[model samples]
Target: MEINQFLDATYLKTASQANLTEEETQQKVIELVKEAILYDYKLVMIRAIHIPLVKKILNEAKSNVLIGTVIGFHEGTYTTEEKLKEAKAAIVLGADELDFVVNYTAFKKGDLDLVRNEIIKGIKLCLDNNKVVKWILEVAALTNEEIIVISRLIKQIVFEDFGEENAKNVFVKSSTGFFKTKNNLPNGATLEVMKIISENAKPLKIKAAGGVRDYETALKMITLGVDRIGTSSSEEIIKREKNRNKGY
Candidate 1:
């Protein structure tokens, strides 16, 4: 089904996280950009620091692959101002999409105002900059009910405040692929969780990130109506897709 078009080729690890030198990390990003160019994947999702490098390479290659970066990554504890500031810098650095980790901690603490405020401001900033925006809910840390509520909350905020036309530019993403869960439980998008999100957060798009590693799982996500699949295994998935097409 030409799955590369639905993939957001992702590499969001830092040097320390991967135990690599800074140069090695840059090389990884370079290879990722090259792979995206080769496959014509929808976008290459990377850390904000690498936006300029990615932008330069894509521009030189004349590749239309979009650049996406995270804001308030991993943890959603950052204040709204901080998230907005990070997003502004990403925009300035040539990011076409901004995925902000939503402040679920505040929502868990019964601080609905904090959650609402950030979503409003964050979505506004990205829309104003003509950038696609996605709110990462970090489903691993949340209960099913929380996922339903937060998804609905985001949908409501975008539809009511931003109007129907702008809702298309927003996405309700499943995870940052960085949340630590108890007992090494699945830390990314699970189909069950995705179903809840998809039903609750419509009008806005859905991006199922983390734990989506192979062609079978990725195709399932697409069949389940996810608009984008974010993963670091784009090449492997593409290989599997080729095998399936070849009846191997």
Candidate 2:
């Protein structure tokens, strides 16, 4: 498969971390959008606040690269109502896809009803609005068994409640890329965890985010059936692919 087709070139940094003021942050997003257009990436993932700017830039350049944003990002602690509001506002701002951080903490605490309800609401809203939806499971923060259980749960919910075709538009994504981990272990997609997710989330689509920094690893994810890859290293990965193809 063509590697760039699976890449969601990302830049989700906050203003402070990126060392940019508000205007500068928008400029950075503009640059990212330009790069995504140049590379023919599948999408450009940015924060929700920048969706309008991204839409404007892509429109002016007449680029079709999709604009994606995260809701309850980096933390899946928002209430169902709150997440729905965020989703609606994002859709209004012209976001093509919505990646939501699932309420995994509640699930771990035996609050499966709450988790289920939230995910159901979130997915329905996105589907009804004709927007792609992805649930960020934050695998780095869960146990192996938790990963399987949650992945299965997401698939079960989407397929059973919304039918298989709608489930195809819903993705079980691997990470938010900001979850703090003990010992600084990789905080994003890992092959083993992805294998577990792919095995369980069949027909629901899978997106491997975080920690996917190089061309080799990205290709491995495609081999493992990842439909989308989220990374800040899209340019580097594409550059590496070009060099390798040229036998350099």
Instruction: Compare the candidates by lDDT and give the number of the best one.
Output: 1
Where in model 2 is the C-alpha error above 4 Å? none
Give lDDT tens digits, candidate 2, residues 1-248.
46888999999999997788988987888889999999899999999988888888888888879999999887899988889999899999999999999998998898999999988998899989999999999998899899999999999999888999886799999999988999989898999999999999988999999999999999999899999999999999999999998898
Cα deviation at 155, candidate 2, in Å, is: 0.6
Tell me how many residue pairs clash in candidate 2: 0
For model 2, state the Cα shift of residue 192 in Å: 0.4
Give me the displacement of residue 138 in model 1, in angstroms: 0.5
Task: Indicate the TM-score of model 2.
Answer: 0.98
Model 1 agreement with the true structure over 119-145: per-residue lDDT tens digits: 999999999889999999999989999
Off by over 4 Å in 1: none
Ten contiguous residues minimizing lDDT sum, candidate 2: 1-10
Q: How accurate is candidate 2 locally (lDDT)?
A: 0.92
What TM-score, computed on C-alpha atoms, does each candidate reach? 0.99, 0.98
